[model samples]
Target: MVRVGIPRALLFYQYFPMWHAFFRALGAEVVTTPATTRATLAAGAARVVAETCLPVKIYCGHVLDLVGKADVVFVPSLRSLERDAHHCAKLLGLPDLVRAVVPEAPDVLDVDVDLEKGTLAFYRAIYAVGRRFTWNPLRVKRAAAIAWAAHLRYLDWLQRGAGEAEHDSETGWLNDWHRGLTNVAPLPITIAVVGHAYNLFDAYACHDVLRRLASLGVAVRTPTELPASATRAAIARLVGRAYWACEAELIGAAGCFLDDPAVDALVAVIAFGCAPDSVMMDVVQRYARATGKPVLMLPIDEHTGTAGVATRLEAFVDLLTRR
Candidate 1:
């Protein structure tokens, strides 16, 4: 049986089910890298350029992890998910980056997902990926349908407060989310965490920021929990449209949080040295300052120690709780 490897970093948290379902539907064995760990970070950091963002470094480690385990690794080049929005340059060049960094790894399947070209362009990319498994167009269509359905269902599940789990994988991340939501302590403070899905949900990247906040008796709201209409309404308040796709989401979500009376403050979790995030953080900080709301911007890199992060979180929680 053919095996396809997927890295669990970056966009995997957002679209793992779709990828998993698509491969399984086509009778391909799906293998994924383990959750991010200290060793994983170290290994990835050794090969990545010092200037690259932490997520990219972690992703590189994952790709290398699958070197001998699978016949081909999937690293799609994501240019744009919508007509008006484009991704970070790093994401747009991820496939080539991985190939360059891990030349010894097995074949990598590079698929382009640029919806700016047209809707059909996006489908064609998926079709091309599906063709690697089977030549029959009908089978490919069925796989694509299953993938789309799984993606929709995953989104719905997150909205329903079901928390997120890599479909059919070990349940640690999902369990952590649920435990945070159901904490026994009274959560009198509500904080909106605004960032890309990869940053907000990845435990290692943020050093379990969600659980830390919940333990401090604070309720955390992420962009994934917001309604599309609400996000759109928030985006309309911006002076101009954002160019980067993830930055746009953060901007919209930050606006919503700043405008909401129920939310006590805003926390932006970003990767250190990320140019797009640096720009978005400036926008968020200005809006927050003008509105007289407290916003904490936490930037993490490979060198960030968990102890320092915990101390900052503790201090921030104390300040918010007293306010």
Candidate 2:
């Protein structure tokens, strides 16, 4: 049985179930890198150029961790997920980038996923990846169908607030959120943390920011909780289409929170060296200033300290509670 290594960073958080299901259906053992850690980040940073973003550095570290443990690593080249919306250049060339940085790692299976080119282009890409394990096209189709279904289910879960379920990591109790369809008793304050799915949900990356907010007796809302229609509606408020697809979602979520009276504050998590996020932050800050809503622009990098983030968050919450 050949083992396939999947990194926990980047696309893994977005499409883990789909990728896991697809690979499992093809009879391959799928192995995932553990959550990011200081050591992992260090390893990644050492291998990549200093100018690369933190997330990309973390991704390289994850691939390094998979070295000698798997037969091949799956690093797809994602150009665009939607029409007229492209991914960051780093993500588009991820597979090649990894190979260049980590030559000792096992073979990397690179697949191109550019939906803007047309559905058939995407299908052919999937077929190319699937053919590696089996020659049967029908088998690949079945696997793809199952993967798609699981992907939809995962999206539905996140959109419906189901992903807010019990988080078992540190501060789990604080982050456990309401279960069994129970509503949270009106908290004194409600905050919306807006960012990409990977950064917002990954406990290691953001140091469990959501859980920390919950611990402070504050209600927390995230972009994943918003439905597709709501995101689109939020995007409409902007003057033009966002260049990066994920940035659009973040921008849209920020707009939604700004317009909602129930949302007392907004925290925009900005990744260092990400150009789109840099631009998005400017827009969000400008909007926040115009609306007179308290907004915190939290910028994170490889050297970001958890204590610092917590201190800032504490101060922000303290000020809000005093009002």
Candidate 3:
């Protein structure tokens, strides 16, 4: 069986399900690296220049972990997901960056995901990548169809789970989100954590930020979990137009959350040295300042320590509770 390695970084958190289903349908055993840790970050960081962001370094680490463990590593070049939309340099050149940095890596399977070319181009790129695993076009089509269904379902799941994030403290249903929080006041606060999932959800990159916020007895919402219509409308209203692939989610969701009265504050999680993140953070900060809503910008890097993140989160939550 052809063992395919998929790094658990970057788009992995967003598209891993579809990739898993696609590879499985093609009769390949999928090999994944363990969850992010300090060692993984360190190993991957040493291979790249110091200026690289935490997520990219972590991706390199994951690719390194897959060496000698799989026949090939799947690293898609996700240039643009929408028409006329462009991705940051990190995403557009991920496959090449891996090839340059990780010399010991096996074959890296990559497919261009630039939709600006046209709808047909999108299909062609996906099929071309599919052909690498199998020669049968019928099998590949079936796999693609299955993967498409799974992606839609995953999006639906994200929205459903996010919509249900509402808690009724009177009925005692808030206990579910009250884990790890004690000896502190039960402040009924909700915050929108705006950033890419790679930074917000990655344990090592952000020092388990989402869980940390939850443990502070605060409700959390992320861009990926928000409704598509609300986020899209917010984006259109805020900036008039956007050209970046993640703008709709990151910047749009931040705008939506900032304007939401139910949300007390907007907590922006970002990676240090990321150009896109810096722009998004600046936009969010300005909107927040204009509206008088509290905003906390937490930028994580390879040197970010757990104690520091914890202290900052605690301080931020304390400020929110006092507000």
Candidate 4:
């Protein structure tokens, strides 16, 4: 059996189940780089220049970790997931970037996913990737169908407020959210967290911030719980239109939180060096201030200390509780 490695950074958080199902349907054994760690971040940073963003650095680390463990690594270049708007440049050229830095990385199976060309282009790209593993187009199509089903189930899971059920330790809060449906006292504080999914959910990347909030018995709301219509309305009202596809997670979520009476405050997590986020976060902050919502902007980088993030989160929650 051929082992195919998929990094746990970037698109992994967004589309991992689909990726896993598609590859497995093709009969490829799949392995993923474990959760981010100091060592993972260090290995990734060593391969890239200092200017690269932390998420991209961690991606490089994941690819490096897969060097000897897999026959090929799946690294797709996603130019756009929606029309007109596009992904960050780093994500668009990720295959080349990872290959350039992580020279020891195993052979890579890459495909271009540009929805601007049309939604069909997205499906065709996955088919192209499946072809590398097997010649049977029929098998590829079946894999696509199975992958689609998995994607839908994953979305439904997200809507329930529990993140991926796959992890129990670090994401226990994610797994525990359903108990709220059963009947539980609401936490005193309800905070809305807005950021790139990678930065928000990647435990090590954000120093397990959400789990920390959960440990405090705080009820946390995230972009995953938002409705598409609300995000679109927020985009329309905030900036006329979204400059980046992922703005729904940041600007849209923040916009919704500002209007929501239940949410006590807003937290924005952004990685340093992401130009779009820096600019968009500025807009969010200005709007948040005008609306009287206490907002905390946490900037992370390779040198970000765990203690620092913990202290800041504690302080932010403290401020919210006192109000």
Candidate 5:
């Protein structure tokens, strides 16, 4: 049986289920790199140039882990989802970048999904991938559909679980499913978590910080969970200049969270070598200074030890509690 390796980074959060199901349906064994670790980060940083972004460096590390373990490594080239809605340029060049860094890399697959061209164009990319594995279009379609359905269900489950936890806590059901999932007992402190989409959601890579924070009696809010319209309105309310779309969303969410007395502070998590995030973090620091709210900036790299992270987290929480 053919073996395929999928790096558990970047869009892995958004597409892992679908990718796993499709490959499994094709009778291929899929091996995923273990969650982001100090060793993995070091491997990636060693392989890439010093100037590469932190996320990219981490991705290279994952690819290196799969070098001799799989027949092919899937590195997608996602340009845009629609006209003007595009991913960072670095992400679109990932396939080539990985190849350049690792000359002997397993056959890296390039799948481009440019939705600005047309919705049908995205589907064609999917079909093309299916063709690469087998000639049977029917089987491909079935596998893709099954994978998509499973992915949707999983997302729904997460959302439902979050909601139920909130509801159960409100009703004083402390011994229920909600209680075991989070440390939201008594009065939970609200915390704003900011970062790129991929880094924020990957539990292993981010050291499961959100769950850890919850266990420490903190409730977490992500930018993705904020209402789009509300965030836009808040962005427009900015006193002076405009902000980047992603930064604006984060700032708006922070503003909203800060307005509520229940929220204690904000936590900004950025990958070690992320260029965009480095700039954003500077902006966020300035924002925090102006607003007089305590902001903790945590930079993550492969060599990051959870014990150190937990120590920092405890210090931050202690500061929040005092305030």
Candidate 6:
């Protein structure tokens, strides 16, 4: 059986279940890199050029960790899900970038998806891979369908979990809700965290910052849990200047927290050298200052150390408490 390695960085947070289901159904062994740590960050930083953003550098580090452990490594090339609505250029260039950096890298399977072109484009790409490996297009299609269904189920579960948490928060039963669902104790301070979906959820790459914050009695909220439409409305009212796409959502979430007295502080996590995030961080700081809400900007990269992040977080929390 062939061993397939999946890096626990980037989109792994969003599409992992689908990837796992599809590959495992094809009878391939899957190996995932361990959670991100100082060592992993250092290894990744050492492998990539200094100019590369933190996210991509860390992704390279993850690829390196799985180099000899698998027969193939899956590095997807996502151009745009919608027409003229592309992802960060860094994401579109990941596969080629990794290949360039690690000549001895394992066989890379490039999965390209353009949602603007239509769903069939996606199916065809996967089908091509299926034919290359298993020689059975029918089986591949079936497996893909199964994987898609499983992915939907996982999303539904996340929504349900978030809904329940909100309900508990409303009723002042947050402690019970946190214990029953997440098994983590609630923090005395509530923090609003803003970042890309991948960075927000990838425990390893973000150094498990959410968990660390929770352990220190801090309740963390992401834009996913915040109401998008309302946040957009708030952003327009607060900033006057509208934000675009992910930036809009992030700004909206920050705006919502800034207006609400219950949210004690704001934490904006951005990848080092991310152009969009760089712009967003400036806006977030400007907004925070105007609103008189404490905001911490955390820039993460392949070489980011957890100790530094933890100390900063602790200081931020202390600042919030004092204020």
The lDDT values for all models are 0.82, 0.82, 0.81, 0.83, 0.69, 0.73
lDDT of 3: 0.81
* Superposed Cα deviation of residue 173, candidate 3 (Å): 24
Question: Evaluated with TM-score, which candidate comes out highest?
Answer: 1
Poorest lDDT segment (10 consecutive residues) of candidate 5 = 168-177
> Distance (Å) between predicted and true CA of 222, model 1?
1.6
As a TM-score, model 6 comes out at 0.79
Candidate 2 residue-wise lDDT, 59-124, digit = tens: 999999999889999998888878788888889899999999999888999999999999998899
lDDT of 3 by residue, 1-323 (tens): 99999998998878887888888888898888877888889999999999999999999999999989999999999888777668899999999999999988989899999888888988888789788878888888899898888778667755655333343321122123233432234459987788887887676788877778887788777777577788778878777777688886678899888888878988788889988878777777788888999888888897778999899889999887787
Pitting candidate 1 against candidate 4, the one with the higher TM-score is 1
Give the candidate order by descending lDDT.
Answer: 4, 1, 2, 3, 6, 5
- Prediction-by-prediction clash tally: 0, 0, 0, 0, 4, 3
- lDDT by residue (tens digit), candidate 1, 250-291: 888999899998888988899999988888788889889988
Each candidate structure's TM-score, on Cα atoms with residue i matched to residue i, is: 0.94, 0.92, 0.91, 0.92, 0.77, 0.79
Q: Specify the highest-lDDT model's number.
A: 4
Error of 1 at 153 (Å): 0.6
Q: Give the TM-score of candidate 5.
A: 0.77
Report how far off residue 301 is in candidate 4 (Å).
0.9
> Tens digits of per-residue lDDT for model 5 on 37-110?
77777888898778676678778888988989999999998776535545666887899898898888799878
Q: Higher lDDT: candidate 1 or 6? A: 1
* Tens digit of per-residue lDDT, candidate 6, span 73-152: 98988777545556677788888888888778798878887776888888898887666469888889888988888677
